[model samples]
Target: MPGFVHLHVHTQYSLLDGAIRLDPLIQKAVGFGMDAVAITDHGTMFGTIEFSEKCQKAGLRPIIGMEAYVAPRTLADRTAQDNKELRHLILLAETDEGYRNLCKLASIAQLQGFYYKPRIDKAVLQAHHEGLIAFSACLHGEIPRLILSGNLKAAEDAARWYLALFGEERFYLEVQHNGIPEQTTVNEALFDIADRLSIPLVATNDCHYLEARDVKAHDVLLCIQTGKTIHDSERMKFRTDQLYFKSPEEMTAFFGHRPHTIENTAKIAARCQVDLGFKGYHFPRYNPPGEERSAEEIFEEQVRSGFEDKWRIILQKNPDAERSRYLERLDYEIRVIQEMGFSGYFLIVSDFIRYAKTNGIPVGPGRGSAAGSLVAYCLSITDLDPLVHGLLFERFLNPARKSMPDIDVDFCINGRESVYKYVVDRYGGGEYVSQIITFGKLMTRAVIRDVGRALGIPLKEVDAIAKMVPEVLNISLENALKQEPRLAEMAQSKPEIGELIDICKVLEGLPRHASTHAAGVVIS
Candidate 1:
């Protein structure tokens, strides 16, 4: 049988929807003799970097992509009457330009187009379609929905529109054989459209888990996602168990008659070549207000000026304070920061902290290794004197580390928004600034409680089971089962207890939801 790539694979990063982890997914792909896999996680590219790096190490090509939600009208439109429906589209980056465009589209969806889900409209897609390969995604995709609604002309028009935008070589009519009754009808219609428009058809499995037996575990994950019981008839569920990652032979079994469709998966995977340019310095440019001096010059000037002011107060507090030692430390730090290409970073942090203090917004003196920097103390970014406390500046900004220095700042909850606004406005506005995204996963104890609740288990029993999982940080379910003999014995003695533990074990560590990082923000 000819080799086939699983282009619609989702990993744990899909956030409670996908049950497959990257390690097992990579293992399965290699074991199946396939050379590539695609991660089309719903509405986010959270897993792309990890996926790309891991796949390259394992000698498998990672096609970085997202299963994006498209709005019915303009992305900005939000109304109860006319704009509730969302369409799915799979977008893959074919080059560095495509990767950038894909990132732009995802950010626009997140910052501007969010409603029930992050979404984009055709207008934005058209504006940023360069170097991208688009696919009419699963059953939820635009063309499939149009075909299902008995509007062949609209479906054809939609296909042609994408074809014209991405160019014929970059667009494909993606078909899946998941055994959903609608998919059979959708695939037939897609084939008819593909023949008429001369557009190629590509087959994918829309994989959500790793294997056939994992279907039940994935179902439990869906229950946790929807807050529904496995016994609930109306809860959201997959219609078929065919959503697991299938081997090339298995996929060929599903689409044996259409060899070209199977072959198209490899073709698409080979075409997508994205270089994320990892480990490059990406600090935002910080130009001082109305000053023609370079960042290095401005940084040194502020450090020396602030040091003199700080030293004067130090002399008043302690008449024996050594001015030369302070000056020497300040000069050393400035040189290190300048040589490391981090002068702008220090200036940016100092600017915001200064703004906070000037405006009566409470700020933490400093925290972590950042307190070890004399530059931080001079700039008022920290309150502690490294010399008095015997702190090492190299601990904060070691040249040997060869990574960006981290400085953690704390601000009054009520006034932090103002500080953020000041930075945004000072930099370039929302276009150049955004908050970082963080994921909350289903930890061991929390997963037990959640699974028990979804299973309709009594609160007392569920709480007892959850408490049995040791209160250690980031403990896994398997470890908990082994560490607590009572838990393992209960699992063996009682079937319901065994079932509850079983489900929780599989659902643990998958991302439960996404939220903005509390203290971190990204600036372009």
Candidate 2:
């Protein structure tokens, strides 16, 4: 049995649109004896690293890609008509250069091309097409749409244009079967076009959920996404229930007559090889003034001088205090920091904190494990003294862990923006800095309410059902149902309640949206 690779699948990081989660999705792929899978999340690479790592752990090759929203005109063109019209295209990374290009595209899409969605125009794609393999995506793709609209020549022209732009070897005509009547039409046209143009036909299932039974849950997810009830006459819906993670055997059965379509998936999967640079830290380069002292020397000098100043302040208050203990602890922590090759990291953080304090921005005393570091205290990165507090420096940064130390700094709400501005100014502004991304998930109670609403349950009833869920962090729907007997009884007694609970259970813990991380800003 020849295995088929999933080149166009969505994970929960696709937010409300995708129901399949990363861990279970990867596990399912491995269970089906799949050798490779690709996550083409909508307009973002948020899940690429996590998906790649999970796939590697499961002994499967991960193809990194995105189902990008391609703007009809230039990305800068935001006319009312153009704002709502965007086509779909799938871009897979074939090398490290492709991965970098993907990042650039995603960043530009979110930061500049974002109107109703993160979008990129063909111009942007042409500029960043190096090391990438592109697919004329699902029915929403330009070629497929053109074909479905009885525009065969236009469809062929569109396919030829992409083939020219991405190069003949890097472009593919994608075919899918999700039980939609229009898909059959599109696939037939694609086959004809592929035959004429010598373009390979790649089969994809467009997986949105893990199993066939998940169709109902995925439907509810779409309703939640569109703010509509399932009973609505006019609402966005998948025309068919065939969008599950299909096995190689199932895929072969679906496209067996055209075996090459199935085989091309494997070929495309083999071509993609992305390294996420997980082995080491890519810390931003710290440019020291005048080159008089290296970053390490300047870091040490600052730490020593700051420690002496603190020691002098303490000496004035308590003359009999032992300096040897403080000095030994400071030296040990400094040695550990230097040994870890984080001297520049410490200096960069300390420099910003100094700037914040000097400008009258109220910084917190200390927060998280970072307060445990004596070196942090010496550099004024934290105000808490580890010795007095009996905090272990190893907790913050240990030789055994060998990971980058996490230092979470809290700034006063009113002054936070100013501090961010100062960082941007110091680091050469937006070109060198950007905020990190954050994702929001479908928590147990929230999912229950959402599912109930989508199922057309009354708000009062939905609220009552949601209220039965225990207010506890990381508590699952199963745990809540077990803990609250009344909720279980209601689910068993009422058909609506039972359906809502079942749907919520499937959707729980899936990501609902993405936003900027509150406190994380990347310098470079």
Candidate 3:
């Protein structure tokens, strides 16, 4: 049997569409005796870092990739009458440059090309195609779609275009056997195109789940994603049970007649090598107007200047204010920040917060552990004085913690965009400054209601069942069943109820969707 690698795979990071969790994915890959696995989460790279770390720890190669959405036209074209044609494409990072290019593509798709999905046009692809390997993806890929539409000529043209763009060695014609009849048809035409163009044929399962037994739960996940009942005949469905991660032996057997299909996957896996080398801080550079001094120098100067103003306020509030004590605390905090190489971080936060205040944008004094920092108070990043409030600066930024300082500032709803705009303008363009992406997981209560709905349970009954899960942070269905015996009784008494809870257990904590984090922003 030829060795096969899963070059097209999805994890829970693919949101509601995929059911494979990362930890189990690693375990299964090791158990299957595979040396490498790929994570091609749909239109996103949210799981790349975590996947890479876990795979490395498990002694397997992690091929960081994305199943990208390609727009038929320009990213900016969103006219109502326009086709807004979208197709799937698989992209793998073969080098650090490839990883960087993948990041650019993901960001551009989200920031500029987002329509029904985050998308990129061929123009952007032509520019960012370097250091990346291209696969025609599953049946939803451009070439396959064209072939299915009886445009074999067009499909061949698309194949040639990708061949030229990614070069002979970097491009491959992807074939999959997901038990979908179209896949068989698509593979036949894909083989012809590969032969005519001298491109290689690679096989993938287009795995959405970990095992065959996971098909039902994964199907319910799709139902939850589409907000449809499983009984609905017209509901979107995978139409096959074969979209599960298969072992090398199983894949080799499936493509026995075309052994090279199995061999090419291993070849691709061997060629893919991406190291993110995540270490150290790349803080945004902050320079005070007309000051050539280092961030540390400027940071101290600004803190002291601002402290003088704060001192006057303190003296007014309490005539017996301990100036020496306050100064000592401020010195300690500044020293810690400077020594930790976070002076630029402090300056950057201070600059934006100051901008919000000067521009009459209502800003919260400060919140969270950041309110405990004397440096923040003196810098005007916070209004509450740590000494007066008896707050420990160690809670915010400690010398021993060796972590980035997190300062949470609340801006008025109407003016939040202005603050973000100011930060981007001051630090760099949109490429350097972007909001952080966050995932919303399927928690206990939500999952119960979602699974119940997809199972065609009445709304009132679903609501009652979901409420029994208890209102707690990060509770699980099993815990809910244990905590509330009445819920467990219902699950035991009714076959449907037991099924709903069983499915919910499989999906709980899986990411349901992705959205921008309200306050989290990355500047580098």
Candidate 4:
């Protein structure tokens, strides 16, 4: 009864659209002694890695899910003819297959159905919705839209469709109330439909950020997103002052009259028995033909070939620059690559890059520590030469410690798929290659700012106070206030300032959502 999980959350993985910061949100949830939390970021699972990593470290149950935008029809609907826009759908990975389906669904949504946001159609859902728990999402959710349009029968029909896809036990009616009039109207009809259909009901706060007061900054953020002034009535919006994270106590109080709704939240959590394990690396595959050579052999060939070519460059450039310098570096790099058992990784990257260059793909000159290797230069993995650029090969491969050497190759965004395809073709693509997952945690400062604003903080005051704290990434407001004299002075001089920083200190660093990294493709 005391511990409650945040079932719906959005961290910055919602990008600028979500104000929640991961560190603060997770910390706050723990501080409040909450049991578990769900990260249902809008559209993409970009934050999954960060969120899950932190949650495991902090001993919190991390629920992985996405607030998907449903495409009106199939994303393959190629007629430029305007189609009725789709609704919001909440998809949670309940099993390994569900997680995989979620990834494919998210990928396809971005690749094929990107209209206003990443989206998937009913057809796509029909294919991959198995093993996923479905929730009828925010007011913009499909069933709510039907009810809002004054069609109770239509709303029931929509619920029936989801119930059929996910089964009664796996699908829940997501009811939220942020004091919006539309929410009130929809809840009434939603409950009616759930009762008629014999479907379960769950309560969600539709948390956009961490705190209520953050609503204003989030409003300002909305302004930033749309290029609209804060005063515009025509702007697309959240439409409520009440979307901040509420404590279990507060949540219970909000649904005091409807205790069943509050109880249902815990019931849904009980039904959601998901255990996440980070047992193996989700490496992108480096395929090779079984008849030609084993993957290991192909990989070793690339490294040996790369080292010889690098020796050539060094010998040519510094005919007398010390042969020991070239040999010592090459021997060390090769040894480390072999020891880590990642010759496959190096070869896989090299093969694709070689193909790209041969096809005139205009790959990046170099980036990261890989730019510092002579072997990389000679093998065409990178254009930068350590001998010329005075780069360090140790940065790429350190003999002192072993870690995967991350060499990112960038091509024109439009033609990057060809490069991806080449790698998939060479390395066993589908089974071997898998994208890494990350998560977004809520943190202090941001959450308190959100809570303060939701309860109502003047914008000018919030800005002035936020400016007083020194800007340091990854430090909580509590630490910032203690370390910085300026923040200490400001808090002492102003009572409201003290309150603002005080509350943010409590809510700092909770896992508010999940999202994917931009280019953190893991190659094993």
Candidate 5:
């Protein structure tokens, strides 16, 4: 039997546009007997780590890819029209090199190429084309748009350019069937170009949801994204409901005439193998000039020196406290930290905290389980002494459990930026460090308001309806409606309210926006 794979999948990380959640999506793929699946979310790799982990757990090979928005001109050009005319390009990481390049491209897109969307131009693609497999995306892809515009020569020229950039073996002609009339035209042209150019044709569904029945829910999500109602004819929508993840049998039935296209998906899936370094921390190395001490040695020296300072202060408050117990606890923590290869992480964090305090930045007293570590107290990472407070070292970090130690540090709001700047300057520069990305999801109250506004409901009515939802964490609209009978009664009585509630139910829990993480910074 010829196995089939879905090479183009969009999870909820596609923001408001994609309706499929990661867990259910991977489970469905496994249920369908799929050995491999790909996640090509829009413009960001935010879900890559989660998707990869879930897929691996489900016994499915995870393909890390992104459906990138390509700028019409240079990424530096942010003219309104230039931003508006961005196209689609799909890049899949095939190896470790490809994964690194994918990360670089994604980071650069967010940091530098962000206009209306995080976009990359051809130059950026050419620069980071190594170890990546390129796919001419859907209707919005450059070649297909040119083909639809009747510029067959230009389309061929564009295809040739990509073929040259990503070698012929690595670049593929992607064809999708969503029952759109233009798709037929594009597929025909793509076949002709592929035959002439010696490029393989890979069949994909452009899946945005798990099953066929999810089309309505996915459509409602699109309406939420565009701020339009289902009644609005001019709003963006799929031409047909065939865009969901299809089983191998269904895909073969759809494209049986060209079995090779279906088979190519499996072939491509086999080629892409990414190893995400899971459960591993690559902490930055702290190299103090003219010092030969290892990170562990440096850390021990600092801990001893800092303890002398802390011990003097402790004697003034309680002169009878035993020093031997504190010393034993600190020695145990140092052994555990060194064995775990986290000595450098502790050293790096303490250095920054010291810098902040010496330069007049207000630091918070130790909070979280991290206050339980005696080493942290000695290093001045926290102001509280663990021994005097009888804080357990195992609470902060345990040899029984293997996980990274999370130390929450609070700095004054205004001084936070200065601390970050100092770390960046001390480490290397902006090129070596970048802020982590964070996502905002469409919560229960916000979804109700958004759907109400999009449906042209009055603000007062929306506010009243939203107030019916409880403030419980992770509460769903269904649960809220069950708890508050008025909401169910209103939905049953009024058609508009019923429609708004239905749409909001589908749009709930989807990602609404993205921003930089508050306290996370990565240095490499």
Candidate 6:
């Protein structure tokens, strides 16, 4: 198998736009004894941190990167209120500095350069290229377009310019073979250019879907993206079914004639040592004026003052009940949080929630575990007082079950960004806060549908068969066949149908994608 590691890979975080799921990719990499794998999702680094952790857990190295669009100018100009097409390049973060640069580059592209695609120009690249690796990516790259136009010399010059921009050792010329005629031509010219510049060569599968069978499902995705039906004459199409995560044996067979290309993958992984540690606090902290006090102290002052204010309002509103009960509950809850070593946690939560209320972000009263805390209610961290709402304090911060207090605050969807920004601007740096990363897995139904399409089956039939499968998390084909009388009857009635169903049932539920989870944040 040589030293092959998948470099240009995508996961579901490419958002229904890519096919490779997580479990199988990790399994394949670990099973094959492959050292590392990279996920360069189109235009986003959303999967970078999640992929990093999963690969590490799987004992496979994860290279964090993104396949970013190269804008024609600075980010703001490109994403102005106009549609535009731009060249693409692959960027991999080789270190933490590289990861930060990648995040900044991606943020700028989306925030400023997002007219048609998130893009950045040469100026952005030159500024953010530190600790990063670059590749003259797929046929969509500037260099590949030049080569295809039969301007080899100009392509060579373009290659040199990229090398200069990203540093000679940091840049490589990519060669992919999806059985496209133009790819072969591009490969030949790229090889020639690589030799001239003495830059390394990397082999990638450009895996948009997981298996050969997914070619058609991906085609369907292309249709979905273009708002065209399968039968539309102008629908976009891939040149080959070869754009899948081929097994090491299949890849070995495909490029067995050229060992150097395959070996280059391992070489690149060895050089890419980006360590993504789980940084703490998804929320940024509020800094007090003139360094007058630490975040912790300031937070405590706010919580105590807020608690007193809220307590006065509550007692005045309800003068009938014995005050001892409320006082006793508060004492118990505060003691539990203090013993759990999460008073700071309470302080942090109270601070931002108070800020949100002050700034007019409509926060949910309280949700999930935080609904039961008397301290939370007193501090205005939750609108519903536990006793008043018939909620048990143990449901939130259980004395018997010591764990981090789960305080989830929901804000209006439109203002979540400002809330998140407030958190970032106040809390994090080298020590305080960063985004929590997540991974989405490729499951059975998608793999089955994707595989069926790649084999070039009729769309109506595939859609019908898929519909027979229930719309639940990880629904099984066996269950679908059993539950769907028509599907079982079709399998029994038609031989080809039986084989197709059998093949898909087996391939279903394998890793299909990697994506961020909505509304889940973790702090460490």
- Judging by TM-score against the true structure, name the best candidate: 2
Q: TM-score for candidate 1, please give it.
A: 0.91
Model 2, 131: alpha-carbon shift in Å?
0.9
Compared with the true structure, what per-residue lDDT tens digits does model 6 show for residues 1-524?
45678889877667656756777778877877788888998888776666778888888888888998886555556344323447789998887798889988997786667766777778888889898998889998889988998888888888888887777678888888788999999988888787778977777888887778777666655654555656667667777888888766676667776677788777777888765656433333344557667554554555556667766777787878556777787667766766666666777677677788898989999898788887888778888878877888888877787655678888888777777777666665423444554544434556555645655567787777777777776667777777779888988998757766765654454334444556554433
Q: Which ten residues in a row have the lowest lDDT in candidate 5?
A: 213-222
Per-residue CA lDDT of model 3 for 11-118, tens digit only, reads 998889989999999999999889999999999998998999999999999999999999877887886533335789999999889999999999888778888788
Q: What C-alpha lDDT, on a 0 to 100 scale, does residue 445 get in candidate 3?
A: 87
Q: Is candidate 2 or candidate 5 better by lDDT?
A: 2
Q: All candidates' lDDT scores?
A: 0.88, 0.89, 0.89, 0.73, 0.89, 0.74
The weakest ten consecutive residues by lDDT in model 3 span: 77-86
Candidate 2 global lDDT: 0.89
Ranking 5 against 6 by lDDT, winner = 5
Question: What is the number of residue pairs that collide in model 5?
Answer: 0
Positional deviation of residue 516's Cα in model 4 after best superposition, in angstroms:
14
lDDT of 2 by residue, 277-349 (tens): 8888888867765667777888898999999888877678778878998888888888888888999999999
Instruction: Name the lDDT value of residue 444 in candidate 3.
Output: 90
lDDT of 3: 0.89
Q: Which regions of candidate 1 deviate over 4 angstroms?
A: 1-3, 30-34, 56-59, 73-85, 314-328
- When sorted by TM-score, best at the front, the candidate numbers are 2, 5, 1, 3, 6, 4
- Tell me model 1's lDDT, rounded to 2 decimals: 0.88
Backbone-clash count (model 6): 25
Which parts of model 4 are misplaced by more than 4 Å?
72-85, 256-260, 267-279, 288-291, 301-336, 352-401, 407-524
Pairs of colliding residues, candidate 5: none
In model 5, what lDDT does residue 138 have?
A: 93
